[model samples]
Target: MHISEGVLSPPVLITGAAITLVGTWIGLKNTKAQQVPLMAVLTSTFFVASLIHVPLGPSSVHLVLNGLVGILLGFGAFPSILIALLLQALFFQFGGIIVLGANTANMALPAVIVYLLFKKLCISEKRRNRIIGGFLSGSISIILSGTMVALCLFFTGSNFNHAAKTVLIAHVPIMIIEGIITALVVDFIFRVKPEMLLGTEH
Candidate 1:
């Protein structure tokens, strides 16, 4: 759900840039030296996951894996997502430079919200609870990101209203797919390496 450069107005772009800067700063400040490796690994996961796009009716969607990153990184997801988006823009021009902050905010904000909302459930000792948390977080992240994209488009102009609605509808399947993938991933990681699940919020 990358918003292309020049698609948004100057005011929207400026607001996104300012908000994202604050988030990135907090993420950088809160990131611990020992956690750098984990952050790098999560960033790579996000970078790779969003590359393969699945064509939908009017647009294309991809696996953001933002929930997984959010659960594992907390506020750290901001910087991690920013770095991944930067690489995507630099090499592939996926989202472009001007809209980087807006795209970053769209994806990373949901993750941070998910972290706050479901951190305990995700890290719970109960497998079922963890799975439920994972599923919800994954699904919700996609939905929220789509909403943010729509909002950005709406703010750009009334002409984009139809496009905004279509974006949300196109992402329905993606939300389910991501939910299952995230749930399975969370379960596997919990079983294999429980300590790894102890994120920044813990």
Candidate 2:
């Protein structure tokens, strides 16, 4: 969800930027030189996925696939998401430079959380466990991200209450779609390119 510029309070924007800075630093630290290329590819995928979104009041609805990216990239998702969002802001002007941090934090934080919470399950030996892990990661990340976006708006002012609720409600369908997509993608990757997943980096 891309929260438009000037919608958030200054404190919220600053907090988001600070959080993203730390997350990106950790992401880069965890990223091996060998994974750089894969990181770029996933960044591109994330960039393209949100290109055709339906705008809600302060945010937008679209396929984030953050959980998919998270399970694969782990902490690497921070930099991946930041770069992609930077390009989107620069080229399409989807979100402004001022709001970039908040936007990045809103999405990437959930990705990191997903990785922390479910990466082990995603890389499990059993197919069923991996599938369930993938599904949860996909679905829960959306809920987390949507909640974050909603809170950002809600904290901005009472005037944004409706918009905040709307943002959460609109993403319900996307959560399910992302869950199914992530499940299939994770299972397919486990079979075709296992090395790409987080726990398999070794």
Candidate 3:
């Protein structure tokens, strides 16, 4: 769901950049020292996950796992996504530098929201609820991010009907896979490294 440069108007790009910068700064400032290693690992995962493409119709998409990252890293998801996207741009040029703000906002904001939701669910003190929360968060995050992307395309004056249909259709199966993967991963982490999850104080 990477937006290439020159696809959006200059005004939209500038506004997105400003918002991204401010959000990223706040995320960085809020991150705790103990969360650094987990953030690093999640960021690496985000970077590597982009390389695994799944074919859908006439197009292909990659797993982002932003929901899982957000659940684990909380507000730290912003910086993790930003770093991962920067790496992707520098190494593979998956997204243009000019569109970095839009891309980051689209992907990372949903992650933050999902993280908050997951945190609340986990507060129930039940393993099943935590797992379900993670699962729902993962699924919801994909939808939110995907919808934002569609909105971006629409606002940027792309063929909204075509773009929305393409994105929605392509993302359906991918979202299911993402949710399952995220749930499994979250369960595994809870068993072996629960501290990695945000608000899980060991």
Q: Which is the leading candidate under TM-score?
A: 1
Task: Write the candidate numbers in order of decreasing lDDT.
Answer: 1, 2, 3
* lDDT value for model 1: 0.87
- Report the C-alpha lDDT of model 3 over 23-134, residue by residue, as the tens digit: 7888889887886786788789888887888676677767789898788777778889989999888988888888999889888899989877776774345778867887
Q: After superposition, which runs of candidate 2 have C-alpha atoms over 4 Å from their true positions?
A: 52-61, 198-202
Comparison by lDDT, 1 against 2, better one: 1
Query: Model 3 has how many clashing residue pairs?
Result: 0
Cα lDDT, model 3, residue 202: 42
Q: Where's the lowest-lDDT run of ten residues in candidate 3? A: 193-202
Q: Candidate 2, overall lDDT?
A: 0.87
For TM-score, candidate 2 versus 3, the one ahead is: 2
TM-score, every prediction: 0.92, 0.91, 0.87
| Off by more than 4 A, model 3 | 53-61, 122-124, 198-202
Give RMSD to native, each candidate.
2.7, 3.5, 2.6
| Candidate with the greatest lDDT versus the true structure | 1
lDDT tens per residue, model 1, 72-151? 88899899999999999898888879889999999989999998998888888999999999998899998898898999
